[model samples]
Target: MALLTPEDLEDLLNKLRQSNETIKASTGKGITEICEEVYGTRPASQKVAIVPITAGNGIIGNFSSSLLAITEYFGLEGYITDHPDITGYHQAVSDGADILLMADDHMFIAHNLKNGKIAANHICTGVIYSEIASRFIHAGSKDVMVIGLGRVGYAGAEHLVKKGFNVYAYDPNTEFMEKAIEELGVNAYDSADHKKFSMVFEATPNANTISEGMITDRCLISTPGIPCALPAELAENGDIDLVMEPLVIGAAAMLYSVF
Candidate 1:
């Protein structure tokens, strides 16, 4: 996953609201509703604790607070700890938090104490975004295209294949592409292929990979990549409906997965 900067998260609550509306307009469901449908999760009646860890690069500005806001938006009770690291974890357990959320530079995770279930951000992100993309393109679409078969990308590719879509996948790394092909029964997509699909899942960290020529006017793109593959102008122009929010979707997915 691409590391997020503090600037990328400014006014994140408002951005998430707009993103939820964007998703609802396309799929006829909000983020929480989609998460529930994808994960078989319902309204969480558990107390959630967002703990800020001062390890690695230390706390990201507003990460814990943003999680608290997201939890509340999902109609769950949540709060940030008064301290950081282990102390915060102890406080969460002592304060009777049923779910614990924490992150280091390497991974973000959600843990449900009652069920001993854990959800990692990367896997949940892929599954959630792929489901959103699948739902976005309603009918007359049988093939799905996936770019960047990395950790996150591979998970989405696997899910799409299991859903009975002819998943065409590509990555610069031949090993990753081969693994997805052999393991998940996905079709290999090469750069020479000019054909486009009704749904495209962009998970590459690089930008400008999904050019305008590759997408039709009715395409629906679901991307979790930090530097999105599509241009900003096209995402807003009223042509294709694009779903590209950064961390919020993944965080919500993790929460619901463990919920």
Candidate 2:
């Protein structure tokens, strides 16, 4: 059976909003830190990992997995790393991995950057993230509020701010909020500041974040287009939409047509 429907999507979104309290009660480490601790223990110049990863965690893991597949398609070898395992470190290093392909979780890539050990590549969930951010900024959304602050959230916020969004992020973890303000110069508000921007990009993996009531009616909510932690309801509703598959095929076809 389909995991999500329109009503289910709304319910899931509500649940996500509620989960914020729990997230707030926990340790506030940014996604970059989480990723660093996960796969940055080993240091090599030309290593890779390929293991079980999917879009289940939303765009971060899904995109990372996709990136791993793409790199491998180009003839690169990677260590197969999985979350919820303490031994991924040993396995990756043993496989001679210089660059570990893991989930695009927070602080995982950022930590690698700070350590100056390895380069982290992010798999984008949708081209729309950059597109929406760009559009909103061009329309003068200076005090932009980015929700989620997870892998995709952080990436979107960073890109948006770089383009002069004056990004303000909303996440349950204090760690994420701090990173937004300190590292990215985003305001990091805790609540929904709907009136501030004419456009809003929903980067949360959970499809439930943009139910009828959660999102402002006036703000433009660009769907992930790419698969992520999408609620089954949203997936089934067909309203949220999917873009990655079509975009990929379209790009390939266009290239072939041009060639």
Per candidate, the number of residue pairs that clash is 0, 25
For residues 1-259, could you state the per-residue lDDT of candidate 1 as single tens digits? 4678878778887878877876888788999888888888885589999899888888888788888988887889999999989999999999989999999988899999888999988899898888877777353677888988987898888888888888888898988978888899888876577877778888988987787666767877889987878887776768577788878898889988887
Model 1 scores a TM of 0.94
- Lowest lDDT 10-residue stretch of candidate 2: 250-259
Residues 5-52 of candidate 2 have per-residue lDDT tens digits of 223233332333332222222213221222233233322233355433
Candidate lDDT (C-alpha), each: 0.84, 0.42
Weakest 10 consecutive residues of candidate 1 by summed lDDT: 133-142
Q: Model 1 segments beyond 4 Å from truth? A: none
Candidate 1, after superposition: displacement of residue 160 in Å? 1.0
User: TM-scores of the models, in the given order?
Assistant: 0.94, 0.41
- What TM value does model 2 have? 0.41
lDDT of 2: 0.42
Using lDDT as the measure, the top candidate is 1
